[model samples]
Target chain A: MQRILNVFVKYRNSILYLFLLGFSLIFLKANSNFHQLKLEKISLFFSSSLYSFSNSINRYFRLEKENQRLLKENEVLKSIQIRSNTLFLYTEGCNNKTNFPFDVQRVNIIKNSFQSQYNYIIIDKGAASGIKREMGVISAKGIIGLVQAVTDNYASVISILNQDMKINVRFKNRTTFGSLIWKGKNPKKFSIEDVVSTSSIKKGDTIVTGGMSSYFPYGIPLGVVTNLENNIQNGYYKIDAELFENPAELYKAYVIENSDFKEINSLMQNIKQ
Target chain B: MNSQILKMMGSFVLLILAQVLLFNQINIFGSVNPMLYLLFLVMYPFDQNQTFYIFIGFLLGFFIDFISQTGGAHTIASLSVSYLRPIIMKYSYGLTSERPKSILTDPRKTNNFVFLLIFISVHHLIYFSIAYFSADAFLLIIKNSLLTMIFSLILILLISSLYRVK
Candidate 1:
């Protein structure tokens, strides 16, 4: 008995080590089967929660870029809506006619030049898609330009940012009309020339296209009044407006064809004769 | 004595956090994940009781297995290494069982390097073998163990050089 006790005391640490190691091996063998599935479930719960928490943080940083992408997608949908002729046909008492006076064809801008004074845009549609010269072009946000030239498969547009381009515009209330023209300076801004000084235009009035010409219909948005300067000597208001359409970022456009353009021109030629 | 115990407890928590949050997610060369949690076992004071070392190893391994879903592989491997660590130290550093502190603080870099290499290789061998327990996966086990051992050794040496215990 005494010898056994002495040996036990002398090698207690080694005994403990061996005992625990054997216990661990047995535990491993026992839990190697179905219990592993349970363990995996528990671990998945923890790791997935941690991953979602980190993912939420990552998503917050990308919200602005996501918003821009959504806006672009919305523009594409709006262009499709215009091409199907369902957008403007909702006006009261205008449901009987299936074909409206104007037809819109959606086209993608293949090439755009905004830095030069005489900016021009090339679109993917041409005479093959019924596109021709003197047709109005507009983006989802506002008016872009007019179709200046066309080939069998493509059309070049006289951009609204060009110095030679001008379009008739009116205030939102239809109180006064003016000519919208770019000043060869800022691409994002254009000046409404020939507005009489007696006009009641404010700093933030909404401007839209005037239907005086046969190209564009009434009430297509153009821009807003950013600055208004009254030239007392010239008796006109040098109205500066900020454009809604960004020329450099114009990806899609709608080509508006006035179906009665030839009839209206021929009637005016007969009157002149 | 109390401060040393507190420091050990702090190291225990830190090692587990680092293993779960960082090291487990990192896969170098598409296969090698440096097992940095083993540093706690390697850097534990050698002058402590052997039985206590084994108990700590089991606890640490069990906790890591619970978090990483490794199902007793870590526990078995860690316990084996902790139990046989004294013998390895004796063989690698020419030290006896009575003077264990000299092995850690010793100035000879080669002896320390050899000791760490042997210890980590043995741990990784047992770990990979148990984790991938299949006859067809023999080459896979060896390849994974050897690659992990290399990366773990580099990381352990770098961490030790930065923060010397003594």
Candidate 2:
């Protein structure tokens, strides 16, 4: 026993380091997939508070940019409202009527990270504000991401810049659709996969959401194609596109809710079963 | 003793704040993220208890990881660096009865530069390796670590020079 004590005393620092390193490694390994997701939730509680405090101070410095963005969004909303009102008037006289399928809720991004492979953005709205998992999130200029998880008062979004996130998009005015994915490097650029070599694609062509999924409506602007490469072996084009929204500077976003989402999902599930 | 503890506490708060608020937001050259918080471990007094430094390193790193959602990459890197600090100091400055008071306050600029280089490089190496943690990302890990280490070394040197420790 005494010999063991002497050994312990002799290498106490190494033992301590090994113990602490083991502990951290355990944490690193344990925080895989679900546990990592849960860890993010717990960490979000602390990060959100810290970010909120910092954002209060930081928000003032970006007031000019914020004001300009809000003004432009307001203008877009106003134009949409005017067009929809005219449509509503025209449809009122017709027997068959069309209605907008998605509802938008404005929320503030409490914390944002774009440097990591699995980037996440936490917003101030959650279940209380009708924000739910899988709801699409959009900034003023374009699509941001989709809600991954939700707490009582906060929702975490998987940013389009994340490697794991794949958004379905297509060239504006073209029928060919491709999957947009981040290459885990640039915050502003994403690559479009599965676009055929024969597709009518060009540099400076606009990319927009396909709206094949319930998350986003068709025609929401995503970005512009910046580069294109032909993969003769795969018969697919590797197209690079620049995002419209500067995610690092994004503060306000709109959470989109598809009213028919539940009905459509249940029907699809039934068909699969 | 009380003043020393107080100074360390102040440094802990200041470094963490600067890391989370300022450096975290700055992504120079797309991938080079300067982890200036490692400066705390770099500037830690060498004469302090080795075990205590390890614990402090763990606590400091864990706190940053919790905030940044990086799991325990920082904790592992910080603890390893802190544990190896004594050996690093011994090699850089040679054995002596009294350790150098501060890395920045080292009169020999070359020694200080060497110490900073090894310290930041090791930290970044461990940090980026764990962060990427994949066979395919080995090249990415090395690229990120080297790029970040260079920038971090420059920033740490600049900050330490401006900071005069009495």
- Among these predictions, the greatest TM-score belongs to 1
After superposition on all C-alphas, the RMSD of every candidate to the true structure, in Å, is 17.7, 26.1
- lDDT string for model 1 (A90-206, tens) is 353333333445667778899999889999999999999899999988877788889999999999999988888878988987569899999787788889998999988899999
Report interface Cα RMSD per prediction: 4.0, 3.6
lDDT of 2 at B9: 94
Off by over 4 Å in 2: A34-273, B95-98
lDDT of each: 0.81, 0.82
State the local distance difference test value for candidate 1.
0.81
Count: clashes, candidate 2 = 0
lDDT of 1 at B152: 94
lDDT of 2 by residue, B36-63 (tens): 9988898887767888888999999988
Q: Give the TM-score of candidate 2.
A: 0.44
What is each candidate's fraction of native interface contacts (fnat)?
A: 0.51, 0.71
Evaluated on chain B only, what are the TM-scores of all the candidate structures, in order?
0.92, 0.92
